[model samples]
Target: MTSRDTVTDPLPSGRGAALPDGGGVPASPPIPPRLLTDLIDSAVRDHGERRAIDFLGRRWTYAEIGALVDRAAAGLQAMGVGPDVRFGLCLPNTPYFVILYFAALRCGATIVNFNPLYVEHELRHQIRDSGTTVMAVIDVASIHAKVAAVAEESGLEKIIVCPLADILPTFTSLLYRLFKRSEIARWPADARHMAFGDLTRANPASFKPVAVTPDDVAVLQYTGGTTGVPKGAMLTHANLTANSHQMTLHVGHGAEANDRIMGVLPMFHVFALTTVLNFSVDTAAEMILLPRFELKQFLKTVKRTRPTKLLAVPTMLTALNKAAASQDVHFDDLDFVVSGGAPLPFDVRQEFERVTGARVVEGYGLSETSPILTCNPITGVVKDNSAGPPFPGTTLEIRSLDDPHRIMPQGERGEVCARGPQVMKGYWNKPEETEKVFVDGAIRTGDVGYLDEDGYLFLVDRIKDVIICGGYNVYPRVIEEALYEHPAILEAVVIGVKDDYRGQAPKAFVVLRPGQSASTAEIAEFLKTRLSKIELPREIEIRQSLPKTLIGKLSKKELVAEEAKKAAG
Candidate 1:
């Protein structure tokens, strides 16, 4: 593989063998063809009548979902949406999202995901930057106003409104309209505002299929833009389809077409977009969709649905574990759990597994890689403090921080680099930024980690996140892991704070477990044996809860900003 090659090479045979430390299961099964739209048609052909989406007690079979997708695709095509036209999707995890996602792909249009919670300015900037043509927004009052206000300025040609209860059964829809109507966002009355129902009901037949190839851009996934203005990561059809195949090869073992997977994370996030939604469509498994995470509602849904598998994050797992202590939550039916989007603490992993009686394995990835790069094998041994091995057909290396061009030997901590069929074509329209991150056909994951002799990877911290206290590198994760070991600590994060002598020192934020308490001195004393002297936090702050990212991962960035504001005040 090289930077000059536009398409990633296909995986070779014997590439899926079990890793040495955990003993490989078997060579990866033959990979299916690389086409994103094919997943929908194949699932319908194989298991047409099986449940495809279970939302708020409303269920839609695969046959029904496929029919809706075809109708939506036909309707989108009729509305002048064609190949390469940028389509904006701004909705939560509902049946509307699933239908519109596959429908856009089926129509050969590039899908651009938007966080439904974005304000007017944020939405305007993304729409103007991505050059979106048709925007699909949720029928909420605030969201509709924001989109409508910026439509002309952003050069949006058309707008579609999807109701939260569009796909619900008639009775359920009536109930939602009656009781939840006030809470639901109201739709706009503009001539340009058309309902999702109108789109599907008006066109009940399939449209002509366009000639889309693997090289065509499928998605314009935007980065968080922590460094600067957000840039869209251009993921081609081959990149998404190949990454989906690689994920299935690693985690799809024994997942039958009839199995059910929980879709709790918002679909707008790339982690859920690829792993949960795309993976379920690839495996023909039913997805239990929850628009948002509510503690009581999540527990009830789990009891009623008994999903076979769940794709989760560390914060979600910690919340579930906390809920299990006081509430009678049922997780015994779950086969396994896959956690990603952030590092999974060893204590959180152990507590979650013990309560649910299921293996909780952590995976690592970024949005630019179509989201999956490495994962702990479900059927193999899960190494402690490691994110397991690289996915089958994926290549990983640790490079020096000072000189990224130089690859470091195993066991040496450095920047984690990955090259695979999953890496994005490049950052959309940012050639210089893309060139900086991608070299020799590999994507530099800003994360810092090292590989053991047996090829298992152990994460240290992000390159930008490493705190230099008194000239000694202090990795926050090591301290956070030690905090989790304490019975009273439920969640923790460490960030560097300015100091008079040490230049910058570590500050700990602790969230105590329910009904338990621990002082800052007690926490520091407990970590004395685990972390070196310089790695210890200079100050500890106790709070009810720490801030989290949109996907619920503990966000050190938010904590750092909050601390900075407090210092200024």
Candidate 2:
């Protein structure tokens, strides 16, 4: 039952050539097939008395949360959620997500995370693709409506509605229900709907522990693949737990109940799911949850909680860097900040650290790699424009872009490939697509980057046109496809444009059909229903003709260069 039990068929050493200090990648023994639930169990046993989560004015300790998970797991089992069951959680940051995530896994059900901002169209594709039968959603009107609309037509059968005011402080709950009652969605008392209170009231004695293993799929995190379509990465229990181990090792150890992690990123996102949620449970740190990040509220919470750690993306650092100069925010309590999910700019890091006195380090990985592989040393040398070195138990190499089979020399720009226990098994139900991403037993990252002599990874360019807006991946193809739906559009091309606020945002260029015309505002209004706010293009430029390749295929390279020139001007 120990955490370090041995595992067989270890990940290979994909490191092509050794560098100084063994390429700054620490060596470790074989990675064990560890279960994700084991991590929370261990934290509960060790730090049961410590505070585990804080949302709004409410809080729960590890022991209290563990008991809730037990009862919830029993209720889920009674609802026919067990082995081979796929449970979807479409919720924002709340205690319900924290409890249900582990509870569903404890019931031997595969967890499928959904973004609360998804429109009905996006929800339908994922539900059908992943075969999610039972779903947990917040009772907010728009969010619940989207799921309910898809439930009847899609494979989804049951919906577990969690209320927002249920976990709020008693007085706050009354005020929320009284004033914000219109936000609540109404559903009938039928077989398809269940309340959170009912889900958590089952007798703990009836909870039969299912026999779970490490290799079983734990979570289905969807990310845009090489084709710009969202695909679920089948993360095994071993993959997730090992990544937690690797993250804990990278962050180093701290005193018991010492750190409070600031979690502003969406819990459904892979980076925050691993770093903010799992990492806190692994270290027994108190997690201060914010439903969404607002500059005023974030600083207010920081002042109140005095958190020691902050898990952030580049845009967040950019905002804080600007706020620290004028606002009365004090970041003295922040020990360090780990920036991931998007590339962290050099000046953003330098300015933030200079003003706040907190060491901000950049990290890199994809959802397919349990969301983390390389991070700069916390208190050690941090190179500019580098994603630091590979974590222990992970091997990263630069493979030639043209030939996935060939590994490139050191400092050569090529696609980044990685192999480790933290890597997912493959895409769910897509064997043909899965086969194309792995070469020589390593996951092809589809990013053009090189490793320095010290083994630090530098991402030069992305092979895919995925725009990272405010730390979330926004696919250009998704936006382009949406634009083509307009009758007036004959040709469409989308590219990532630099923005001062969001690191990058999608920008659309379209050519109107002969004798047909559509205004930018008109096209934008059309896209509101088809695309999420983040997926919407910031600018839609109508043109007589869009740049095309020799074969008349829509091209984006010329558009990208033009944007760069304008930005320079």
Candidate 3:
């Protein structure tokens, strides 16, 4: 069978054959369609006294959080937030992200998640593109100032300013107000601005409920992926909730009933939105929240909070491995850390497991599919370097590169396409782009990979990232993985650069671990046996650090542009 015109995957693992009618036996119970708002209500009802959030020693129980959500929802409604209103959340991982997220949804408004690190121009573009009228941001000058400028330029209606020090423990809040005063911004006294404390009032009587449906747009998750063109994936309530359920099914429950998840990944990012935030809320787990992934803070969070599970990007594992080499660090309470949001190099996983004595499970998905389509099972035979298998309601099909409609034979490399309920409705308001991305009902994953006969996905690299070296396809990930096998290399990034001999050739940049070094020649020599001549990078440059996305994935966009500029000049 062939896909029509164009379009996408998910195949269940551990199954000899898929069910006849485009279905498969779920590894666990199927996730029923539901509203994202329902997750909070159920958690509060069943686990009211359970600790819901822990930020800088300040804690809130599920009941407390639910009450806050109620007040915020009422306030949001009074501020004219309801169906069709796009509410933007510009926040780091904090209690505010939790409250505002559900409150906006509870008001029957669609949320547009914004990265607080975005510059004014980036913020302006998304604000206009997403039609975000109201936004909530922290009082930190660096974030709020930019958003404020963007609001002025982009016609945003209201700003709910949250104080940085207000959410901390009393003594810590005092210290922050005294010492970190420079970081806070002074909001202009105007009608456009409101305090977060005021926005979430203490009156439950004023709260009015709006009926939320499973298909309502919950969040407009922006993803550029490898394409470099930012488009908002319209993730609905069902899409977000079902993916969270899929994660629970895949990971199952650890031996202990109480689980604390490390929330270092930014809440704005879909991976964390589903795994850390949504997953934790549904399971009644305490979220040990950090504003960002500072290495010292992460190690302290692991030891201090005793997080039973963590969802981390590759860079976090690298930092932990580097930290463990210097001093004693314990991850004893962690059942296992699931690595996603980027490819997990074998050496990084191996070293993390060996040094900290914590298990690492790798998963794969994109922002378009509610961010999780496949994951390595928590307590099962996990294949090394493969992104495990499809989640319970997903089907994966690998289509030929030349003709995407044709399904590739088993064990052959091609583009992965998936069909599942967890997939987004489409790109927001961009019908042409949306149509281009979908072919035959499956969401086309631009990733180049193949599924093994046993149904495990082994991703090669992004199709756009593949270098056509002397008319032969050469994957940068292959060379980068080889570079990781070296003792000194801490991080590796390879990008296709313009070459006179070949159309495009691979160029490598690496950062060495502390007190460890190897010249380009030594690294080239190391890769001689492992890689073919064509797979070798044209030139290797050693750098103190490499570029990374805010979520900590090693980025190739900057390097690609830098090389292009040099070539143009």
Candidate 4:
């Protein structure tokens, strides 16, 4: 789409500009009424021979990707998977994940993303909640065991397994087998269920795409569920497509089709799902995929790929800076770093700029809004700590957290509310919860932030006690409940502590039952099966008593303050 077609005008302060036309003022491509099938087909026809995805020394061109997607779609069609069916994707970051995601979309199916690290209980909860009947997972023995344990209980009828080296080079496959197998377990025996190779080989490389509308459900994204249970936020094709367009306009001046983007962020998260996956697809840019973020591996990948732009959370940036400082490494080719998903600490942003010699810009959004609302401008002027101005065709307002109807004045901290095309339709199957967040057509992000006089957004704190550790959201209550399940633990309060690389790590203060004893390592290991890696506490403090409020309720705020004081000393 042409720059003029995408935006009405630049921001009033001239901090933001319209998305630049690639070569000239070409006519804007019409936004598809439906997503998934239409976008993939069109990209394949237009950029068929171009490389679309790069991973572990292997690449997949658009034409090759299209063929694989077609076969997968046909295979799914044969399995009676179509509209209204929920398909769970439990694989890591790989080309197969991308292909299956689009293929399922082609058949008018809803994708339910599951973290690969989830155990049996966590897997069962999501599967039963989403009513997922089929799952596409990696051929890892531990993961397969977990899936098997939950399949019957959750009513999962079929399991499709893909190998890690399905697309990797022969030598790399050997290397992985010799070294990485113990870390990422291999499951040759589980290949008996449904081989991805057989599915792709047996099906034809062609399938009819399903017709859908803007309102049709595309993705059922589940949140951290800090309150009670994890719930899916129902996002339509229009919601995602509109957000992509809005973000494209917000940061399009310097980004080009030829620019290389690092896709280190997990695609399962909403921020990366839209920015790294869909945005890269829209711009026809090549993406360098990292399966998981390991400091050494990530640095090596960055040095090899030399990506010009990066979309990462604050934790990733912190890690990059620490690695560079401790190892004396350098990153001279990076152009810009975009931080989101959690509030970016001022210190991390400053250190990243000093180490990488690139601007680290911050943005803000929620899963309910296709995950992007504001971003620092790529041209004119930039703001260091603020999530620079709202994207085109978007409006932002701060309202009291207790009273959503009252709009707070500028520079005053309150709940951030957003209104734009990117806003989701509602939460999946929860009308009461949906009504609570959607007020006057604006999505109420439980995050508390304020807008300055110039319209730049500055986050203050989260209304919910959602702890962000290494870029993953850890609900304090979830961890506390898990600890409470232990017989030795009487009461527990979880809080975040500053860390050099992980941004924040969970620290639990526990009041054990009288005369009961447990080591920190013991408690951590006990909760490992119940919680994800990121949610586990780095340290546990056994306390004789926990501070309580006037009404005898646990006070986590006081604990956080005490920890901050200790750090300062």
Candidate 1 segments whose C-alpha is farther than 4 A from its true place = 1-33, 169-171, 185-189, 204-206, 225-228, 252-257, 465-569
Give a tens-digit lDDT track for model 1, residues 387-432.
9888876678788889876777768888887766677877777888
Ranking by lDDT: 2, 3, 1, 4
Tens digit per residue, CA lDDT, model 4, 1-569 = 11122323221112133322111111233333346566667668888877888897688877888899889989888777799899889977788788888878878899988888987888998999899988988877788778877887789988888888667878998888778777554444543367778777645644655776666778888885436357898877777877777667776642244667788888888888888888777666678888888888877877777787899888788777777777754467677888887778888888888887887888877777888888887665667667777866667878877787678877888888776556666778887887777655567777788888787888877777677776677787788989999989999999889876677888999988988988888898899988888888888999999999999999887898999999999
**Residues 30-77, model 3: lDDT tens digits:** 557778888899889989999999997789999999999999888999
**TM-score of each model, in listed order:** 0.78, 0.96, 0.79, 0.90
Per-residue accuracy of model 2 over 1-569 as CA lDDT, tens digit each? 12234322444233222222212354465566678888789878988999989998589999999999999999999999998999999999999999999999999999999999999999999999999999999999999999999898998989999999888889999999999999988988999999999988899789888999887889999998777888999988888888887877777784354689998899999999998888898888899999998999899988888889999998888888889888767777888999998888889999998998889999999999998989999978899999989987777878777877677878888898887778888899998888888876678888889888888999999887688898888988898889889999988888999998889988998989999977899999999999999999899898888888999888888998999999999
RMSD list, candidates in order: 11.4, 2.7, 11.3, 5.8
Give the count of colliding residue pairs in each prediction. Answer: 4, 0, 13, 1
For model 2, state the Cα shift of residue 365 in Å: 0.2
Ten-residue region with minimum lDDT total, candidate 3: 1-10
- The regions of model 3 sitting more than 4 angstroms off are 1-28, 254-256, 465-569
Better of 1 and 4 by lDDT: 1
For candidate 4, what is the total of clashing residue pairs? Answer: 1
Worst 10 residues of 2 by lDDT: 15-24
